[model samples]
Target: MSKKLNIGLVGFGCVGSGLYDVLNRSNLIDAKIKRIVVQDPKKERSIDQSYFSFDINDILNDPEINVVVELINDSASAFEIVSQALKKGKDVVTANKKMLAEYQAELIPLAKENKVSLLYEGAVAGSIPIIRNLEEYYNNDSLTSVEGILNGTTNYILTQSNSGIGYEEALKSAQELGFAEADPTLDVDGFDSKYKLVLLLKHAFGITVAPKEILNVGIRGISEKEVAYAGEKGYRIKLLSRAEKIGDQVVSFVAPHCISDQHSAYNVHNEFNAVVVEALFSDKQLFYGKGAGSHPTGSAVLSDVSALKFDYQYEYRKAQSNGGLKYTTDAFIKVYIGSKYVNAIEEVAFYSVEETFQSAAYSFQVGWVKLEVLFDLNLNARKDLSLLVLPDSIQTEKGLSELIEKNLFIYENQN
Candidate 1:
């Protein structure tokens, strides 16, 4: 606790380099500890020679290193590395949201059993401080719902397209700006948001739901008609990660939503991510900032290091006593086969709410129903089917304040 904390870096990638630079910089915290870069000696693993290097074994065996900072992006070795470090009695910090979200139940218990802190401030919202903020400030107040634009690549693409640019132009601009990944599949297809949602589910509600439970739908299907209509109606098209406790069940998804100017989510344009969490106190709070990349995300990692080096004594954490939740899927008013499954089931279960009764939009099922009924599901309907909770920008006249107010109010008595 006297000198700087020793950092054992598992990967020398962009985030790893930012961590190295932060700890070593003279003007900042004046950290005295040095970071040792653990490399696969068998691989080229090109990095500055000045960085301390040894086989992965050297890091696990080195008693001098009391903290392990994991920046490795893959699941295979990341699992092994963090597992080994916790067993060795070292505190851990990581930015691998994908691995953390998928294997949290497997490792969180291990870290707790070993009396070591497994910190992941950099895993979500980059520099937004969303994770610990909810974990520390909103305990016991029933986080009834949490939603955000969690992936920057999709956000950037949608934001750019909102200005009249097409998806191709927006994607190219995002790639050029470094907001989109080179391959961009995970971020574009909503896998990245799904991974981040896993972290939110665990941290916000103490619900250890897997990424698969919540439907993951990318923004690729967002149409020009939708965007143009939203823009005209005073809304922004964003790939929103929305989760809520509906009636007796919890339901979540990643999809395009039209948010109004009244919501902060509409302001989170470009690569920024924003979260609106409904707490038990009947409050809906907003946290916003850049969602990813080297500097900002590394800043999140450094914040964890600073906490370990100076404040772990005061940090309080509590895992749910029961620690088990059955996933919720009961909110399905309508169910259908996806468009991709169109060849399988021609007719699907389609319900028109009291609010959307006039439009008469019917859902098609590729695998679940007979080929004929797809034609008449919407023919019978009331004129007032509930508005589909579409984004504000998309539906100029629609409002979610009633639903949002309902969600926020549920927490008041409980908090």
Candidate 2:
């Protein structure tokens, strides 16, 4: 029989204590939790830590500890903890999604060099195992489309769309349920799904574009009327985190889309999440589960711990692996970036629609739109007058005619 692995937990907050709960029940895996470490000494006094230490050095310096679990929330400092652990040849299992989302570009390679597994099962969809599924099961398959209810807070907020409740009331309900943090800007503003998308890009498609590159849209602007209209039309409005390979470009965004009963993700309500994958071989695959919860998320971290606890034997003897491939963002999807920040400025001598934004361009899309720009020499010079700069693609007479027909640029496009 194999011996139990010695483990260390970094954060003793909601997630850290939950990890201990899940590990105690794993019948197949035996682990000796050596110590739960903390950076702040006050935590040492608050919690019973016969095996706890305030210094990080205690975990790294210990010769018996084989794996370190980082449940810390801060991305910048958590990065340091995981990196230092790898340098010392200790495997790492983390539930810190923000750190991985922001720094997976640099961290994955470091894990390979040290021959230590950096497993993040709790990052994407709680305990649903989206990252592991993409890395292991979808190795040979080409994933074409990805759409999911990635944010629990936003989902709970928008559930009120059907109830006729306002945004403020919905947010209060979410806060009471503990689905949202004290500062809900990250989840409500779409930064949470943006980070999860980065993790998906790294593991599933092997793309490591910066979070700033992808277009992010939150559900805040969606009005109550929009939700009611969606139901009236036999459809539902959901805040979707999506990444699809459109030819040579990766089209990824988070927004509320109108969907009918044919869509599986529309049925994923509340804090439960779902991912719809359009694979080349298999027509479609749906992964659904609780996207966030103390116990569920902690169980996900335990899965990673189990993987790391036995990874040494799996790689050498069992031929077991989470095989991940690498490819550039352009390899699978073309990034549609307009050189000029103008999508509209069509001068038809009579009509002008795109006179709003001259500073920034809009996000990429699959739909079609056109708007004409009427040049008024007196009004064009002023910044507020709406004379947008045009690129060569829409500078011609024929382009102006098309722009007048579609009338797309009158409203605000994705910023």
**Per-candidate alpha-carbon RMSD to the true structure:** 8.6, 9.4
Candidate 1 lDDT over residue span 39-153, tens digit each? 5655454445656676677678888888889898787789889999999998889999888878988888898788888898888888889888767777667677889989888
Give per-model TM-scores.
0.78, 0.76
Residues 170-242, model 2: lDDT tens digits: 8888999998888887887677888888777666566676776654556654555445445665766677777
Worst 10 residues of 2 by lDDT: 330-339
User: Model-by-model lDDT, in order?
Assistant: 0.67, 0.66
Q: After superposition, how far is residue 240 of candidate 2 from its true place, in Å?
A: 1.0
Clashes of each: 18, 9
Tell me which residue pairs clash in candidate 2: 248-333, 248-334, 249-333, 249-334, 250-333, 346-373, 347-373, 355-386, 371-403
**Candidate 1 deviant stretches above 4 angstroms:** 1-4, 26-35, 38-48, 52-54, 310-326, 333-348, 353-415
- Most accurate candidate by TM-score: 1
| Model 2 residue 56 CA deviation in Å | 1.1
Model 2, runs deviating above 4 Å = 1-3, 43-47, 312-415
Error of 1 at 398 (Å): 22
Reference-based lDDT, residue 209, model 1: 75
